[model samples]
Target: MASNVNIEFRKLFINNEWVDSKSGKTFPVINPSTGESVADIQEADEADVNQAVQAAKKAFERKSTWTQMNASQRGELLIRLAHLIKDNVSIITELNTIDSGKPLTASIGEVLQGVSLLTYYAGLADKINGQTLLSDGPVFSYTRREPIGVCGLIVPWNFPISILCMKIGPALAAGCTLVIKPAEQTPLASLFIASLFKKAEFPAGVVNMVPGYGPTAGAAISNHMDIAKVSFTGSTEVGKLILKASADSNLKKVSLELGGKSPNIIFADADLDYAVEMAHQSIMYHSGQICCAGSRTYVHEDIYEEFVKRSVERAKKRVVGDGFDKKSESGPQVDEDSLKKILDLIESGKKEGAKLHCGGKRMDRSGYFVEPTVFSDVNENMRIGREEIFGPVQSIFKFKTIDEVIEKANNTHYGLAACVFTKDLETSLTVAHAIKAGTIWVNCVNYFSPQQPFGGYKQSGIGRELLVYNKILRLSLLYSLQIKTCKIILYCLTYSMKFCVYEMI
Candidate 1:
């Protein structure tokens, strides 16, 4: 929590200039703690989307200087941008805290991690390489790991800076131009980041942002034929829409990192105290805005009673208050809309017969505050247990068998992330392998690295992003058969072909 977080920030950023909404219509960015208008953001539409696309197209077309530059030189530019971020780290961190109305500690610390990711990707820029394969046919048996064209990145409101760094660092490192659409709720930090990129002189349209609603801006990015790749982070439902939209349109490469209703299973032998804390952190962090939030808690039948008791006590102890207030452990919800959804889900849980174990009421005051909530006697079939509540709410269940628990955990449309807490390495390995999520944790939750490839299974997403040298891997696999001779000698060895002189050299 940071009482120092302020919200009087910039409105919009497009093509290196700060501007207002196209129709002069501004949307209020509320401080969830105070229910006050902290800042106003530009409400972009199709016109703004077109502007961003055109700018990206122009920048990508001007491959003369940027495209011609050595990968090492491009890496230098990214390194310089990283240094710039470090120099002005405080301002950007504060911007994130204010705009998202999340805890200042999480905001500030995650922003620094974003800078680290940029630096890491910068260092990796020159290392991206395709391999010289032992080809079946003759010719240049090697591939060139190059970039795709102008890419469109649509980031979510939750974990904005960190997620933005994930896409931008890798996309730029791959030498792709971009058009960015930041979520409407937390667009200020993105606008400021655009300003930072401008200062870093990221070659005008190498990176451009248009902050707006998802329907207009987000849809536009996917449907646009000019975009060669689309990287999106949001809900599973919306990710499906983006996938359909891209398929209906250009069939361009679409990468989606979507939702999760993670399960944190605590066996009888696990430490009760540590289990309670991990359960809370799994769903309570960022007011439960995490996509991979461990909303489901499955405890062994032997310790189930004690687990719920301690978990409720822990939830009650949390100081629910404003995000800006440094002492506030649980901050307000992002806005009225998000709070309504959360409260509605809480009521749904009750109406559906799940017992409310702890805090479930909205705070009787200004701002979008909900008490640190938990549910007990929850069935796996309940909507609260099945759907992605995406709030500071937790539910507990009991199980006897590891296989049964694994089935309960994987019984969802989502496969984003999951957790297991036990000392038995054999059991840990077994349970981890059984879970269907993209990432699994033995005793950890919400842990991530830019180096680790992150995405989901089923309808959770398609393809992958935030990966290093992944482009090289794909290029090598896709184009390893680029060689072609007349007919009979088409399958000749690389060393035996006439073109072998240059290919082998």
Candidate 2:
């Protein structure tokens, strides 16, 4: 176990300075594995949120250093941040493990993935460009790309640093300033990364981070009129509220990466052993807290019974303990509330007629640990089958035909990601094409890459993230249009006196 995992930063970061919340309130940050308070983070209220937005707005002004700086320079700073993250991977992994209740190895992988993403975005900073439009003689018109001013970024608790990088990388590369709000349950790693942002020498007010509950700090960011856009990763319920808040306030551009009830389909013709192992990793990793987790598993009826038996055996072998423990394959839920919710979902599944195969109880420990659970004979209408449990509870269903399974899989309201395991290329391609998810993995699970765009279908989300090249280009075009509109307005007003101006009678 990593013994040096401790809370380092507790203050809110604004204008490149560490400051306390204006409200003078604080909240305890707990380690889910030990049930111990790591530290008290300064809680930002509406007033502090206003301060952050103002700071970001200042930095995003045309004359400010952040907005006026060279694109290559901005990209260089991101590269520096990526290097710093690579250097401090151990500390980051430890902090995330303690705060997020993820196994040490998993935390390490997430940190490294974050590093890769940041580096990838850094390389694209100078490549944001626009094209010349076709025009007649004496008229030359072209498109120019630029930043979106100030952005409000809300990151979720699970995979804190990964999601943070996914949002901030593009915003920074596009020359936008930011006000970031990390989830209340896991804010330490984000604060640590903010320190690195300062170390990378990003201009003051270019990046700000506030830590607090959703109703206050999160709501404030969503409703702040000065924020040009908001990028959020969390529950679908909260995502909807953010949309409403944006409508009520500035009508800012919004991007949401919300909840999922992703399905994993296994065909009888496929390799059952490899499929079982991958499926186990899909749901049990991080105790199934991943937003794109394969919570629902559909196996061909021919191999459904054998799949369930093997899956239960594997679940029984999982080690549920502190995240810092090297031998621990899975850790606890993020907190007491999450533990309770997971337990409730498990019980509901039992009452809903899903047969409990194994592991439907909590571990005998102090932390918020739940057993690695598996249930069989689950139907689509069951509570566990329909909702995102967000824990180590796996529900298995039987399917006879591809047509029937495709309809059942697409029936969910969420469609962030899905996976299909089959040997035949035709079947794999058919299933992959038919699934309504934003991301589909054929014969694999939980696969992610920085170059590929990640988002959801329907209620899953609105836009994409980590879309390396195109995102920066799109943001640049939007920014150019905004600036041109302002210039046109100014030019028209300046020449208004030369034309016949009629006043309202």
Candidate 3:
């Protein structure tokens, strides 16, 4: 994996060209698996953001090639981009693993998912259509959907490439250009994908990438007047800032996919073995760095003890090591800060009186590694059960009845996602409808697809992503028009103009 991986694209990508930051400043990209600096990436600042936004503005101009291209042609470009990504999956996977500390298999899966997403949007590009309304009078009225102009896409570190594609596919299919700000922790995969956009023959400035800290480049994107919309995926705190910035500036359309402390409910009648495994993966996969990870597990009191015992045993046996290793089930945290935060949260759980069943300390080995920790006998008030601990820490809480579990599940401000494990259909549907989350999974966890629309119901996020048709429609503007025939005009003038006025209204 090391031999195949290369950090070739590190500079800010503007107008289909690689260039140093205007500030000439650089930041080191650390390899979390080794706690070493892999490469120095050019840090994009406000000036670089302005340049990229200008490029996107130009590309989105009415007469520009990107705007003039037919919908089918845009779809072709996306298909080509998807192909290019599929062809270079290995290197991108390696880059993601090295940059974000995700296991190599998970990175590859995300890359493939990106391809599927692009392809889905590509198919929907030419199929977009507007509505024609029937008028009471001899007049024709219709609505046409047009591109919303240049968009600012802010990607998160947890799933950079996949989330970037989620924004890019629909924006391009809607004929909008983009200026992307990749997360500082993991910008390598995004910058590399920018090169693939060029290889796909996408017009210059159609896709631009600025790699820098959030306060600088990200703030510029949120506050930029030229950007028509801003789509962000990250923490809920940062999402609030972006919303405020948009309101303070041009009031651009903002869509956010934010943080979540999702609930995974296990009933007494559930297949205990399968439920345990799915619940474990829900919290443990990607070291619990996922935004919608099921960090809170609610178990029925009848099976609570057995579930806790099995979960602890599973955590004890789980592998936590370098991402490149095939046998490793989990990888290191993205950086030292994440590692420290997880450790601190684990300590808080202990202090708050949640029973730490197993694995509460950081690994003694190098790199930002932490043990797969499990805490049982957790309550709703406990920090471990309530907080969004974005780490390999699992918190299990005991519940009595269906109503009790449902109340416990909806206690958090977050309503991103939840899962219910049960063999009975009535119970599944009952819990699914009772839950306030945007997505409810029955007998499963962490299953995602391109066709599924994902977002949140409360403080978790603002808008939906994927579901190509709806997403692309949201990226467009609806323009309504009315036209009267000559016969109708003559009749109106000869008879009563009030009729025409009423019809128009």
**Measured by TM-score, how close is model 1 to the native structure?**
0.91
Model 2: per-residue Cα lDDT over 154-179, one tens digit each: 99998898889988999899898899
- Model 1 lDDT tens row, 1-505: 4345454445556566666767777777766777778667777777777787877787767454567777888788888888887787777777777777776667777787788788889988888877676766665576777777788989999878878888889888878878888888888777777777878777766787887788888888889988888889998889888889888989887788888888888988876787688789879887888887888999999998889999999998988776677777657788888899999999999999998998888889888888899898888788898988888999888899999999999898988777788767778788888888777767655656556667677767765656644421236444742311110001121222221101211
Q: Where is model 2 more than 4 Å wrong at Cα?
A: 468-505
Sorted on TM-score, best first, the list reads 3, 2, 1
Each model's lDDT: 0.77, 0.85, 0.85
Error of 3 at 329 (Å): 0.7
Model 1 scores a C-alpha lDDT of 0.77
Clashing pairs in 1: 1-326, 2-324, 3-324
- Give the Cα error of residue 82 in candidate 3, in Å: 0.7
* lDDT of prediction 2: 0.85
Candidate rank order under lDDT? 3, 2, 1
Candidates in order, TM-scores: namely 0.91, 0.93, 0.93
Q: Which ranges of candidate 3 are over 4 A from the true structure?
A: 1-4, 467-505
Candidate 1 positional error at 148, Å: 0.6
